[model samples]
Target: MNDQLLSARDLKVSFDLPGGRQAQAVAGVNLDIAPGEIVALAGESGCGKSTLARTMLALEDATDGSITFGGKSLPKSTKKLRAFRKQVQLVLQDPTGALNPRHTVYDAVAEGLRIHGIEGSNEYDQVISALSQAGLRPPEQYLNRYPYELSGGQRQRVVIAGALALDPQLIIADEPVASLDASVRGEILALFQRLRDDFGLGALVVTHDLGLAWNIADRIAVMYLGRIVEQGPVEQVLLDPQHPYTRALVSVLPDSPVGDPQVLTGEAPDASQIPSGCRFHPRCPLVASGKAAEAGIEEKCRTQDLAVLDADPRNWQSACHYSAQFGRDEVRGTAEPVADSLG
Candidate 1:
């Protein structure tokens, strides 16, 4: 019996373009989430991280590959799908847009119960319990208040309360704190950590912010151009990135000590017309600056395609053709990798 809470194998999601070309939103991804774990899916806007999240939630059908929840394939029937949904919930990026201005706090939280036909005389109690769990103390005081009556953080908590009302096991939160103030972002992230500790909830937090991942996630998967380029323990992948793209991302961190910040030129390539070789080669700083050639893999990087990642999700892995050369310590002329060298 596989004990993983959720697992995706060779997952691929694509959409048709006007010229009959396909835009590969998610191309051959393998990921797994254990019970009570938090995995941050970090990437830029067009890397397809959001599409992958939607596919995991079953909102978007995968063009290929398999996703299993609690050891079972995604439900096929509408009834079964609805039942499946009760176990997993989604938290959108914007709280104001997610909530109905007309609905009171109590009604918003109770909506899920009403939809699932789980409502009864205890519905009010359930709503209160969810609100309390979401950090709205003395939940009754806010029951009748409308969304416009709350602050940004409070509104987000209301959205969270709505999900908690269903007693879900896993949460797929896309940019959960992107729109909040910096002070409030910590509050929300801490709330997520507390929920995991108190209820054994598993979550996949989707964001482009590596700093956010550092704060709340146990593991990090760095995606680029529709595929995960590097993934490992949050500390390892962030502090000692192995792929050129990952290195560039980590370098730009406000406090990163990896030499000078490296800003890659140009935007991410369109998914519809992916590059021939390593999808990131076109904008890869190493390739464009001839460092890859110094190491003698530039031609291979441009002409030969690298295979999709296939290592254990918990292990340190990178999909780049020459990952060993980009480790921060190696680049800085140290004999040991970053973790050991830094220590």
Candidate 2:
């Protein structure tokens, strides 16, 4: 944590909603990305992972808390911020929409360089190197190609190449592989890994896929209802999830070791009208199945609002009140009958 390339402390982002209410998009998130480390922010769609990513990129401002990159607070001046952005690049999902259809691969790759006024006799060389680094081998072959000309994977690589051309230290990829085919998803994920291994590039991959996190991330942070409910090493958190939300997500994975899949009832609550106490209590499997009452934490679970997880980033933490009790038989469904199974 001391050597974190980018860190967000108690970060919060909110937006004005209809009526007099506000949507809490990101609420009190503490995250760190060390040099060369890959951290995946895993969650469902409405959990605010993308908002957190955008906040880190300075595309969205935090309503509270602080964000520091390279051990310094984010710059305020436009000139300074522009320089800061050169070090932190964003790779968005959907390469098709990301790229300019009329632009050639060369143009797409060189666009950032041009924007940052990085022209020189070797600008062309920089584009080629970036393209090659992104795994578009023998880069020259693809330079004249348009976005429509390349396959989905190739188009994604071009998007990555554009980011790499700026020589960024960190990449904040928002669902980078969401639009790709299954075969191409691995290749793109592998490309991200190679970037880290080869260049010591740190990345925060925002995703809803726990499987993707298990495959590519060094650490995983499970986000729910605008907060990180569980976080630790990829194996520790995913294999022995202490938070019910995390457990539910891991259980649905194809290779989940946590017994049967749990079908959480109802949709995620609207951010504008978040539930009191535990924001996830309404959809929590344990609450619906009577396990919480059986364990005598139902009242506390329903009425006590939990704070952020423990401040220590090195240790695994879960915000649930009875996280320690999660080791009980109920997790594996071996105990006597509860009221009903998860919907």
Candidate 3:
């Protein structure tokens, strides 16, 4: 049994602007999330993290590629789509805005149940059960409260409770903790981790915070200009960082004490005018520099496209030609070839 709760293969999403030009928001992304696993999609503001998340949720249409849920391709029939939706849920970035001000907590959580034709005492029990699962104990007390009455964390919990009411198999969260206060962020993240523990639910969180990925995710996928540059186990991607862009993002982390830091320059290239060859080569130090200290591989980087490969099932891989030299910048007073020192 492939046990993959959700998967995307070579997915691309594009938007056509008024000028008849198209912008590819997500470009050739391949990802999968298994039950009880957390995959963090980390990137800058316009790196298409949210776009990819939406495409995975089937909220946004993909211009190219396919999405599969529970080992089957997307359902085209209305009955099948509705059944699929029941198994997959989306948790938006803002909880306060997601909830209705006029509706009580019970009403908000029961909306999904009612939509599926669940009503009467059965609906009430499901609502209370979901609230309790979300850590809102004494669920009856919160049943009548409005969105305004609850704190930010509590409001977010309510949003999660709504999703839980329907017993979804997967939850795709776009910047799930971005809107909450510092104190509340940890609590909400813990809730997500607990969800996996309790029901073996799969979760995919999109965020720009590397630390958050380190704190909660089992795997980390680094994105740049809509393409995934590197992805691997949390320890491998965060500590070893096989790609240059991944290194730049990890270098600035508060606990990263070793390694040389290369500050990124300029803004991410526009999607419509994405540079030729390796999309990240223009700003990558190694791409322009020689293979050795005095030798550069500018020609190779400018004309060739690097494809991601499976290095080992345990360690994640990158789509860079220079994957062999990732940590060499911080050589620690060492020579390129250890045998060279003997000469």
Candidate 4:
């Protein structure tokens, strides 16, 4: 079997705008996830992180791209989408919205099994197993309870149970803990970690929280303007960012040093109005300071869109022409956090 469970290349997702314009939500991107690996795609809101996740899950049609599972290309037909969904599950961001108000927890979880054609006692057994895995103890006590009776955390667990019911190989959780309480967020994150360790399940968690990435993900991919500008092991990307955009992201952390980290000046460029050359050049503090230009790369920064550049020791990659100029990120406080909160 291929080591990679899921792979996507040149992935692009575009939406039709009001004025006959095209809004490319997911620009050219490529990624791979190994079995049992938990990878976090971190980016600011509207950076197309969720869109990319949806495209990977086959929930959204790729405007220009290809997604492969276990080295086989995903099928375009509706019948095959069901088969694909059986192996690849999705956990949406909002539990309240994702769950049905009228249905009990048992009904919510059993729905997937029913759709997939599992019947009778087998469905009951699967739902119980799923709810138990999702941290809802014993399963019987909460089976009949409605969403209104459950806490925010428990409701989210119910959403997770729905995904777990399918016994999927891969789960794409979009903002899994964003709406949960601070205390509950850690529990849910810990659950993700536990699931990865115990079940050997591969997960692609779409989150805006860099802290969450540091807390659990084996690798982190930093996205800017729909492109993965930098990616590698979590420690390398979080502690020693190379791309200017990644540096700015890491420098703002609560524990990072205050040596005037590269504070970006302007808002992220709209997808429809992406800048020429480097998409991030307008907000790139390094380029804004005229350093890259002074170093004789100014013209390229203004006219050439950067591509992913391979770094040493394999896996680690950055997309900036000036990435070679940076060293390890400065972090004076080395106190390890027991848990991190989403911003």
Candidate 5:
């Protein structure tokens, strides 16, 4: 057996607004984090990445489908949920806000252990070990310091230590470095990679920055307006994107340097006003008949929603009317390959 640590199937989270309407924050998203893999969920803000993270951790109720951990379905009971909490931990975007202002760093890191009934010399040793593992050197110096007393990087490290203190099998990091200064972000990214390597931890990292995803993710899942548009090995998806939304996202990536010099255009539809037919057709460059015909793309993009198509079961997959036509810019040896691939 493959022993996947976390799997979310058709996960959807919707909220009822003031009127008799619903806002679908997450819509039918499916993902699996195999043991020790770092799966990044990348997209623009409000694209449902964070919503999906909360749903996976059962922090929010799912409107549809399920989340399974270690082959077992998540239980609905509070007691069972508490047990689930011990196995999954979250590191939020702002470390300063995440920690209690009044508590010492040691108290913050040791809080999880205390709640789980872990105590005494062994737990204290583990607390120090976790802080050290997160690269908070001179662990003793940090133990009594409050959040305001630490630097941004050090405060973030303390939060990471708190998450690690629980001995969690999976960590859900929601833009964990987005709030940090540029100088400090790289170190935090390295810490996450180190944690994954040393502890064999699975991580679900939600971020809008494709460059960061490219740097740290083993595999990438691209989201658009609450649904997964494409997913595959980081290199495969970043180098060769099949979905139009994925292509647009990659076009804007600072490191990609591919696509037309002209800025890609189009706004994501509001969740309440999603369009008919393919939700992306209005913004998809490939949907125009002229482009579609030249690329050998069919009419499916205009009238049908494409199912997730797996070109190679091992890595590549996409939900696009003409995914087969798309090729990596690297493969074509042109930063802006003739829109030929869109067919």
Candidate 6:
């Protein structure tokens, strides 16, 4: 059997806009997670990071492409899909919204087991074990608590425990730490790492925080305007990014010292109005000229979209006109250096 736990190929997700236009939230994205790997998907809001996570969980329909778990294509029938869900689970950004206000922490965590008909004398034991794994100590103390009674971090842990109750092989965590306090976020991240180590759970963590990605992810996939601009081993992509967008992202990270102020300017482009050549040309510092320039090398970036090109044999890939030209020097900015603050 293949060791890959999950594989997504050219996954595309689009939504109908106000008019007749359709916004492509995820466009031809590809990714794979080994049995226990933690792959971080990083990008700003509206970059389709969340949409990608939902698509992977089968929460959203795909416009095209395929997703596979444990060497099997995702089920097409509703019943099969429902059965497939038992093997995959999701943890959202806001745990309060995920848990029912009417349900106690124990009920919330046990819901999956009930639905899967996994009841017995050990059901409560399983629930407690999952809670303990999530660091919700004194599981009995949290058993009767409702969503409102728990702190944000505790509630998030409850949500994670619910996912764990299913004993899923893969977990899609969309901004799992986005709502927690800084102090608690590390504990949660450590919990995820421990879960992976102990239970061999594969996780796809979607977040906008590069620091979080740097701290917990084994690999990093940088997305921009609905496409993966760069991806590779965490150290390779974080310390020596090859794509201009990836370089810019690493430079703006609070832990890294800023190199050039120009790299921080501009924002991601609108999906409907993507630049002619490259979706990120408007914000690309290596384009040779500003957005106003209609001629020269800048025009290439504006008119020519690039494909993901292999940068190394370790599965490192990037999509940029001059990905090979990027290096660590770009992140060594002379601007106001920010302290290594965890967000």
Task: Point to the candidate with the largest lDDT.
Answer: 1
Candidate 4: C-alpha lDDT = 0.83
Per-residue alpha-carbon lDDT of candidate 2 for residues 1-343, written as tens digits (9 for 90 to 100): 6688889999999999778889999988889998899999999999999999999889999999999998899998988888888999999899999999989999999999988889788889999999999999899999999999899999999999999999999999999999999999999999999999999888999999888888899998999989999899887777777788988887787656676778899999998888887889999987898888888988888898888764355888888866656653445454232222221
**TM-score ranking from best candidate downward:** 1, 2, 4, 3, 5, 6
Which lDDT tens digits does candidate 5 get at residues 79-194?
88888988899999999889999999999999989888786778878889989988988798889889999999999999989989888988999998999999999999988888
TM-score of each: 0.95, 0.94, 0.91, 0.92, 0.90, 0.89
lDDT of 4 by residue, 128-218 (tens): 9999999999899999999999999999999999989889998999999999989999999999998999998889999888888888798
Task: For candidate 1, write residues 1-343 as lDDT tens digits.
Answer: 2788888889999999897899999988988888899999999998999999999999999999999999899988989999888999999999999999999999999999999999999899999999999999999999999999999999999999999999999999999999999989999999999999999999999999988898899999999988998899988777777787887887777666455678999999999988988999999887888878998989889888877786376588888876754554545333223442222
Q: 2 or 5, which is superior by lDDT?
A: 2
Q: Rate the local accuracy (lDDT) of all candidates.
A: 0.88, 0.87, 0.81, 0.83, 0.80, 0.80
User: Positional deviation of 76 in candidate 2, in angstroms?
Assistant: 1.1
How far in Å is the alpha carbon of 158 misplaced in model 5? 0.4
| Deviation in Å, model 3, residue 44 alpha carbon | 0.6
Evaluation by lDDT, superior candidate among 1 and 2: 1
14: Cα error in model 2, Å: 0.8
Which digits, one per residue and each the tens of the lDDT, describe model 3 over residues 90-196?
99999999999999999999999988776777898999999999999999999999999999999999999999999998889889989999999999899999999
Backbone clash pairs for candidate 2 read none
Taking every candidate in turn, the Cα RMSD to the unseen true structure, in Å, is 2.4, 4.1, 5.2, 3.5, 3.9, 3.5
Q: In candidate 6, which residue ranges exceed 4 Å CA deviation? A: 255-258, 261-263, 288-296, 308-313, 325-343
The residue pairs in collision within model 4 are none
Name the best candidate (by TM-score). Answer: 1
Off by over 4 Å in 5: 255-257, 293-299, 308-313, 324-343
Per-residue lDDT for 102 in model 6? 99
